[model samples]
Target: MGRAFVYVILGGGVAAGYAALEFTRKGVSPGELCIISEEPVAPYERPALSKGFLLPESPARLPSFHTCVGANEERLTPKWYKEHGIELVLGTRVKSVDVRRKKLLTATGETISYKILLIATGARALKLEEFGVDGSEAENVCYLRDLADANGLVNVMQSCSSGNAVVIGGGYIGMECAASLAINKINVTLVFPEVHCMARLFTPKIASYYEEYYQSKGVKFVKGTVLTSFEFDSSGKVMAVNLRDGSQLPADLVVVGIGIRPNTSLFEGQLTLEKGGIKVNGKMQTSNDSVYAVGDVAAFPVKLFGETRRLEHVDSARKSAKHAVAAIMEPKKSGEFDYLPFFYSRVFGLSWQFYGDNVGEAVHFGDYSSGTFGAYWISKGHLVGSFLEGGTKEEYEAIAKATSLKPPVEDLAELGQQGLNFALTISKKPQPALPIEVSRSTSGLVLEKPVYAWHAAAGLVLTASIAGFAYWYGRRRRRW
Candidate 1:
């Protein structure tokens, strides 16, 4: 037997969850939509895997960190999906996708057909095997990507509490996990080849602020080197990690976050690829009209930068998914997916938010010694990006708005001197359409945007509330 649906979302992650919520919000009919995911549970916030999920106390779990909920929206639990008549084929992977036939063949020997398709396959974490290292499958070795990976990591962390843990990678995953492990009382030694952590996004000065804080917590940094091999015990557990610098860090557990590869294998040759991901238009629609891609798999135009980028972050995933749905539902009035990239992370007691691109010259501002400080990236004589640490919702919004405006940077020295004052005054000159603010709790751990700071989580809330959707042609024609 086969199942037919008006809309089928392939892959259930953050994007799938948010898309399902949007569908329900726009008045979807029962049995009209289905989400096929490899995970047994419905979509949850994937970031928690590296942050709250590994905490020593009140570790985040299912339903608690569900998608949309983080945005202060209704959490889409499996029960909720059932109530909405949305099918969830969890624990089933799509073996192949026939875009022309509008059918997806599952590894379970099931064929599902859809009048319209949305691909939210997301991405897979890079493995140690790919980096010439072995024993990633060891019991103590962990990689955080989804619920299962997080659960496995928590289990390993618990068993190896107060033990030495080696974390590979210096990006978001590395920093956040390193903090979590330290809080859990595990000795953390972070290894990355970058001169400092978060090299791609953070300036040397900004990176120093975080590095100092991490150092205070006894987190060691092994920079400018990569993991070469792993020493495993007879039980197939990684006991230590050998690095390229001819050094070895003893490890009771390993948390790897080198990078991720977009899960676009199924769509190879079936869709146009760009920037290492499936290329899509502003609508997030791929080469095929009936098919759309979102999350880490779709490289769409970034109107803010006048270029295309494949952003592997939760904000892009949620926004792109919702945008694609809106476009499919109402092509004429859905509007273009003009999104400002927002990324944030909470490690220990420090939280930071970044908006726009990190290209061009950077200007440091605020007191670096204190908790509150930031920087702005100027590209082609425009403030194209902003980074803020320990900022109020209003302050964060100021920089985000100012940067997105591509505000002219007349003098670098003057801009540096003014610092936050420049961003604070930017909106008053030329108001950003639908301005947003970034906010969080005083603890500096709760990443919250009180109002329109539609950067990431809060933006998810604002966007969902007013996605400006109309009626899907296929659904309207079928149900009406």
Candidate 2:
């Protein structure tokens, strides 16, 4: 059987790791996989970097933590690929793709060839090019796509005062950024052109709940507003922000956490794109058989959503990468990765968790009136999604398993009972350990490990002797 081949994965993030894991699981040793990432540091979880880590200190506020990139903050070293025998190339950029030749030209004039390729280049924060910042005026505005962007924001926030902050969008990142600024006691004014927060993904009721929840905590919302340009002071600092409505607000610092677009310019027209993300089939494979894309880069079709949409969730990348890897290893066998979307955020001392599509008629419980409780999104009387505050790990895992099972269970009470019952009955699954291998190959060629057959035979003999002695002792005990 063919042993190994160079599986070159571009964009080292969650999806790439999944592909690597899948390859390893299929017995393609570590030396055969290679990953290239542009970022200097290895990939880390992007969610915690902005929300949990960016806590600010104040009397009304809780003790703050330094958030915004850097895996060291959480002691999460990027070791998945390295431990799996995958060659990782960091601080490198791929300039172009020669798909026919199966080669990638790096910006540094180096060409790397691959038998199978994966493009998980993901996406970059979409910048409002028409608008400008006050203090440091540059086209390269601040974004949180990578660690470097997070570092830059942290440095800028160090000297930020409690003046006025003009946030461009009311999306998740923008809202999270606004919440972070408010916690810092910064006079934050979130500008949203829409009537409600997260209107695209959330209903008016949920959006209103989030709006009122944050508003009570001193976050000011300037609804139905849009920014036209940025006004700076004599010192070249952003002094004020100008809106399209002939209105201007005094601003000391600004964070435009609007949204992001896929970074797929290198591929040009080689791959397919639906709404700017590369289009992938059910198996997480792209139009090109040998080329695959995952994470934020691939625009996948969600069966529940009934339409193709690009999911920016962290878990999506991880799962999709695994499916891609499985497909690469067993070309004849089909694999599918479809999981309900899950999102969580911590704001105002509340642990908020939402799962699946947050649309449809929501069957709610607990108390939104009390700013606490749980709610489930019900569509056609089917439990589609859930929104919760203050749920335990048991609840989290139960919900996950419920979503994974077949013959969709409709009874909420039964689901909860089953969830709790399973939690109590089953021992928690152990985390899988990384495989050990002496040598691996990258060109579809397997390298032999230095193991002597004599040593194995001696070990087998030792095992037999021990078993024989144990059997003899058992017989003596029976006779007694």
Candidate 3:
């Protein structure tokens, strides 16, 4: 004998929490919806684990960062789930799923069936052992992915205050963790195989600004090298790290942020895979009619780029999860998911936001030395992407609007001179408002301020366009 639900959401991460909230909003009946998660607690914002949660003082804890709160929406605590009659199967793992029968077999030997299922298994951090280096089993080594991992890192940080820490991997986790360590008065040396940090997103010039800031904080960098091995003390704590460049750095603790892989192993044979994630349609529906995928595990069509992408950012996870639920509940009204790639991070009094693709020639602007700078990417004479640091709320909205429109650029030199002015002008021009429902799904554009309708004649009379072109002609510099 077993229980069943009309809807079963797999995975208790950001996506699961958002999906649950969406279900409640769509009027899911009592006892009809259930969430199964290995995590004992309800979904909280996962990004906080790497940011506010790691603060040296007054650190953020669970219940303070739950789902929807990141988006400035209602916080969905476990109590919220219970009050809405949604079943919370916490600390439970689904051992197997039989799509044909629409049944999930839990590790506890209970069978829970569902008419429709949402897969949101998220991803797991890649361990150092996978790279042929063993010793991650040491007590001082840490990886931040879940609440438990965050707690463990805090414990390690407390014990290793004023000591040296080696951070492996220069990506998001490595950068953020290093900053946190430094804030805690720990000496940090960041190691990576790339010439500059955040190599995938930030151009060398942009990276330089951050590298300098970190250096100011006494964080040393080891580039173009990888970790060879780790030396452990008799107590099995990491004592030092060996690099490929024949240098050894003493370490009181180590943090590994190599990367992560989506939890798609369960659906390997059961679902079609693409780009290392479960392939889904514009509606976030998998190949199976009864199953849908969301979050980092779903490779769904990105209408903005006219391609399918498996985005690993928290914004993508939250929006995709909500979209999947909307498609499931309001099929007739729900349209295709139209998403614009958005990414942002905040560390050590620095914050930045990027919208759209990073392709094409990049034109940087602003005073880099002043901690206020930005860049725009032009592809085939159209502005396709924008990045800004230390921007106000209005400025961020301006860039988002400009990138979405993809305005044509006559000259690259003028764009650099105009810099933030170009986006500001575009934001003031009249433009069509996105549909109420559609605008909410897309990133970076929705705002409390009213959207202005386009004034064709006024747009043509704008002088910034001409000045921008001429400025670029006189000030064009070598691309970094």
What's the TM-score of every candidate structure? 0.89, 0.74, 0.90
Clashing pairs in 3: 413-471, 413-472, 414-468, 414-472, 430-453, 430-454, 431-453, 431-454
Separate clash counts for every candidate:
5, 10, 8
4-28 per-residue lDDT for model 2 (tens digits): 3388889966566556656767888
Off by over 4 Å in 1: 430-480
Worst 10 residues of 2 by lDDT: 60-69
Off by over 4 Å in 2: 1-5, 56-84, 130-141, 331-334, 397-480
Candidate ordering by lDDT (highest first): 3, 1, 2
lDDT accuracy of residue 142 in candidate 1: 90
Candidate 1 C-alpha lDDT tens digits along 1-480: 678999999988899999999888777899999999999898888887888888888888887888888677998888899999999999998899999999999888889999999999999999989977888878889998988888898889889988999999999889899999999999999999999999989888888888989999999998999999988888888888898999999999999999999999998998999999999999999999999999999999887766788998999999999899889887898987889999998888888899998877888888876788888888767788899999988998898888766777879889888988899998668543664543333422112222544456776776766654433555677898
lDDT of 3 at 477: 60
Candidate whose lDDT is highest: 3
lDDT for model 2: 0.68
